[model samples]
Target: MARRRKGRAISGVLLLNKPTGISSNKALQKVRAMLFASKGGHTGNLDPMATGLLPLCFGEATKFSSYLLDADKAYIACARLGQVSDTGDADGEIIHERSVPELSIEQLQQVMQGFVGAIEQVPPMYSALKQNGQPLYKLAREGKTVERKARPVTIYSIELINWQAPDLTFSVRCSKGTYVRTLAEDIGEQLGCGAHLISLHRTHTGGFEAAEMISMDQLQQVRDDEGSIDHYLLPADILVSHFAKKNLSAAETARILHGQDIANTENLTGMVRLYDPEQQFLGLAEASETGRLMPRRLIVTDETVTD
Candidate 1:
């Protein structure tokens, strides 16, 4: 006998304040079960030892995850100046430890300047990046080290918040794929000492900030009180605000909904925000060299559907 399933309609994002020591996937699953959502995914990952805002996309919003993934991120990290770890953060075994140098605030500030602007970084071994169809962390667990190519990433801003005995707390605004652990290690090496990240917290990614985030407990409370959870969602187009806007006529909107490439967009080159005749957000599109707007990610045809 086939089991009949009840239709579950859940869509939109839940901004979760992920606590330290919980994996991003675990948090996503917990939120999924709480919402009873059929489809759910996270836009970006926060490491197990890292805490703070993790955007979980559910239902139709999951389709536009790439936009969120590519957005820039902000973090606050504490670096232990006298230690190095296999996993780069505090969770792993200490591979090496040394005495921290007497670092003055000014000297630390000077060192931080070198990291601003564009910089090259080698990905940490304790990461999800795959090589030869296997995760690099798996190889690292076996005490094997592999050559990793340095990737170019921009550090939009880095500020030293405080300096204490053997720890330094700082905030960073960086492009996607920037590793705070690697940055800490590199800073330590430059200062003639080795270091590792002791703590990490993502404060923002794209337009999503920790201040505006809701937790799993809060979502559960909302569900219990209202008999529905409806207040946790942000507009899907929030991550694509950096792109240019292109409003389409009703005819164009109909054509686009039918998967027809739009022609005659004016002076657009990169990812563009699309709006329909009713001023409703459609999705993202790219302007072709021939002046056609090609759809990249379309979430829903009706903007009011988010509610």
Candidate 2:
């Protein structure tokens, strides 16, 4: 017999304001425990030294977590100019240093403009990227340096926020998989002074901003008050809010949930948001060019019928 997991089969997304000094998974665990949720997942990872917005998915919301993971992210980073760290961030040991030249804000902005577009970046060794099924950070901890290919990533925008001697702060909106530490290092290299990120904070990801984020302390207060934290959770379908919404008849809903593909002739030719007659979110379906609405991830068995 299969053993079932314990806890509430709740479904929704939590916009957590992740704290520094804890891994993303650890933060998720804390939130999951508070909610007593049986299943939970984080959209993407944030380094222990980083903080700010981290979207967490519980139950059925996990099905659409990938969409947020693949979405663009924005961050504000503090860089220590004239110093280079082996890990490209403050958490690593300093390996090199150089003199920093005094510069005007205009000059700095001009240099930053050059980076506000598509650019190739080499992932830092102290990263989670895998090689031979082993995380690169593991190899780094053992003092090993391996060749890494420079990957193309778009920096939609980059602007200087503050400049105080060797410690400079900047904000950037970039495509997924971008390493802000590498960006700081690259910018330093351009100015003839090496640099490494001192701190980083994600302010925006997917279509969410930091404004809606809840802190662990606030959650604990609510829990102490014996309140339902479920109220803090966003609907599961919020993950796929960009998809075209389609309301299905009771018969169509039943057929779709039963692993059947219905006709998709509503001018939607991609992933579509599905809703039952009562307007409860069903799940997502892929609409093909051949006019078939194929069930992809359904909520019928996902334990929560999010409204």
Candidate 3:
């Protein structure tokens, strides 16, 4: 294993309460510059109009980012009824509008119930999905259309937060890769009224919550405190607590470092968190057979690889 130097490049996870109007990558860049991280990456992408929990990995922690991207997410989003946007969000122009029909709470509640559970959704044209050599958004900008297949997605829970006039706010907990904008459009279609997202705030992702996130102002305060900025960072395994843990002895650690699989521990199944004797995070591994843990991903040096 490569030894990390102190004050060179910090390693760990930064839970950022991403503010609205900033793309997820842009937010990562800002945090990277603030920490002066030599390497960094975010688990998932949040739209520019959305705000909330965005977990950023710095230095060696970037190796484990893929696991975070696979976790579920929760968000609070407001959708405007009787109005349809070209981009399915407030950033798009309103291309269609109609008067809000008299909708009773019970009737609206019934429509929401139908949206629960597993469903297939066709991705919107104004998405980052790539086709041929260009992004779908580029085609949408040029007034071109293409057939998009529906993808299966799951909704764990959705609750109506509040509603007044044409504005309806709802909280949704869904699997990763789900599109809340598409959900809003589908809900509108079910209600016989077009809709689009007006505001979106993610509350949770990859087991990280907004309440645990630090703001840019708080980070600045820590930075100005002289040398305590590193104290604000959480351990890289924070989000991986959901997985089982395996403590490796010196011999086992040596074997793993040599890329050899060891006998699995009984009762251990699925992905697990691997640690050194001192409980320092080593990386991630999967349990196979009755007694063997095979390395799935390891935290190597921060040498960037390009094709």
Candidate 4:
């Protein structure tokens, strides 16, 4: 028999303003400890050098984190010109340096525009990417270099936010798997000078926005003021807000809860956020073309949650 996790079975999502100098997992652990939640997970990782919106899911919300992980992301990235780092960011050793050229915003925009579409981006060596079951970062730390195939990544836009001296800042909306650090290095190379990421701040990921993010201090204040932080958490269904919503009658909900398929009358198909007639969130279901609604994932209790 497996041991059950001991803590509050609290289920919801927290938009954390992840501070720099800590790993995403570390930030998750801190918030989980504050909430006393037994389970917690993050949608995507923000490098220690980067800080911004990091969505932390707890309890049943962890089940839908993959949807947020696959969602698009936006970041405010600042790169320093005339230098290249081994890790492609300020965290690594500088291996190359050169004088920066006097460049106009127009020239910078034109060069950045070249990357604002379907393009190839090579993942950085100090990244969490794995090869031969070992993380590439581990090999990088061991003074090893390996050939990495360029993968297709879409940069929806790279809007130049500022260009002050040797520092250049831009906001990028990109598809999943786009590495902003690599993009900065490529831009520097295009300008005939080397470059490296100095700072990166994520502003958006999936449906969550910067406006929804709460810093660690803010969270502590909330707990200090209110008796509990539970009111601040968004419902778990918000993680899968992309899914179509369907309401089930009491009888249908009962049948589905008992692990039985029910007939679909609304002709809905694909994954859906299933709710009880009273608007309580039940979990998820898949409606097939054959007009059958099958259980995909369900909460363990009748007193789970409402939409």
Candidate 5:
């Protein structure tokens, strides 16, 4: 006999304003416990020292979490010049210090402009990136260092928001894998002064924004007052809202659900969101150039058509 899973089958996405000092998984677990969700996962990892806008997906939403993982991200980061850390952030030990040279705003802006567009960055040793099935951070703690190849990442935009002598704050919008800490360190090196990240707060990820995020305290209060967290959940379909949507007839919906390709009169190519005649979200389908809509990821509801 198959063993049953624990917790309720809650399904939806929670925009959590993750607080500092907790791992992303820790936040997901806490939210899962609060909602009594059977299965939950986070779109990406936010360092324990960093906080803000973490999307937690429960139940069927977990299936689409990978799409968010590859989406763009934005952050407000504070870097302290004149010091370098072993881990590139405040969590690491200070390894070196340098004298901060008097720099004008124009000079700083000029340096920031240089980082815009495609740039190569070596992954930090303190990162979660694995080498030979071992996380780099684990090797870092063991006093071992390894060579990492420079990977190309796009920095859509970087604007200096505040500057207070040794402390500088900047807002960054970049591709999925861009490391703000490495950018900070590289900026410092270019300025002829060592630096380390003092604070970081992700303000946006994918289609979600910080303004839409709820804090843990607020979530707890809502749970205590309302006795249900389902009210705050955005539909699981919101994850793929960026794609073109194709509504299907009742017959078409049934055909697609049964893993059968449907005629693609619309001739749309690439991934698309599929909806049934009643406006219920069916799932994702890929439109091939050959005029066929192929089932990609389908949701299972009581109304789902079976073979």
Candidate 6:
């Protein structure tokens, strides 16, 4: 017999304002225990020193979590110029320090302009990227350095928010898999001074914004007041809101639930959000070039079937 999981089968996405000094997985676990949810997962990870928007998925909502993983992200980062760290962030050991060169805002802006576009970034060793079934950070802890290939990452924008001699603050909007720490070091290199990331806070990811995020204290207060946490949860479909929506009749919905394709006369040739006639979210479907809507992921529940 299969063993059943404990806790309620809750579903939705929680935009958590993760505090600094805690890993993303730890934050997700705390929220899961508070909600007593049967399943939970984070769309992406934030380092222990990084804070801000972390979208958490529970139960059925987890099915769409991967969409956010590949989504673009925005962050405000503070980098300390003239200093270098082994881990590329403030938490790492200080490796070197140099004299800060005199630079103007115009000069800084000119330097930043070079980063706005597609570029290659070498993954840092002190990262969660795995190597031969083991995390690279683990190897780093053992004083081992491995060769990491440079990967392509796009920076949509990079703006200097503040500059205070050795400390520089900037905001960046970049594609997934970008390493902001590397960016700081690269900028420092351009100015002939070493640098390392001193702080980082993610402001946005996919369709979720930092404005919608709630803190751990706020969540606990709601729990103490016996208020439903669902009040803060956004609909799971919001993860794929960028995709076009398709409404189907009861017959079509039934056919889609059974893993069958329906004719897509509109000839939409990409992923789409599916809903029933009553507007209840079904799941996701892929529209083919041949004018067919093929079921990809479907939400299964007792209430899913309807006349």
What are the models' TM-scores? 0.89, 0.96, 0.91, 0.96, 0.97, 0.96
Q: In model 6, what are the clashing residue pairs, if there are any?
A: none
lDDT of 5 by residue, 118-204 (tens): 999999999999999999999999999999999999999999999898998999999989999999999999999989999999999
Tens-place lDDT digits, model 3, residues 166-207: 888899999878999999988988888889999999899877
- Those runs of model 2 whose alpha carbons end farther than 4 Å from true positions after fitting are 301-307
The regions of model 4 sitting more than 4 angstroms off are 224-226, 303-307
- Model 6, 1-307: lDDT tens per residue? 9799899988999999999999999999999999999899999899999999999998888999999999999999999999999999999999998999999999999998899999999999999999999999999999999999999999999999999989999999999999999999999999899899999999999977898999999999999998878778777898889999998998898888777899996777689899999898989999887789998887876645433
Give the Cα lDDT of each candidate: 0.85, 0.91, 0.84, 0.91, 0.93, 0.92
TM-score between model 3 and native: 0.91
- Give the Cα error of residue 71 in candidate 2, in Å: 0.3
Instruction: For model 1, give the RMSD to the true fold.
Output: 3.5
Tell how far residue 30 is off in model 1, in angstroms.
Answer: 1.2
RMSD after CA superposition, every candidate: 3.5, 2.4, 3.8, 2.5, 1.3, 2.0
Model 2: what TM-score? 0.96
lDDT of 2 by residue, 65-103 (tens): 998988999999999999999989888889999999998
Q: How many residue pairs clash per model?
A: 0, 0, 4, 0, 0, 0
In model 4, residue pairs whose N, Cα or C atoms come closer than 3 Å (at least 3 residues apart or on different chains), thus clashing, are: none
Better model by lDDT: candidate 3 vs candidate 4: 4
Lowest lDDT 10-mer window, candidate 5? 298-307
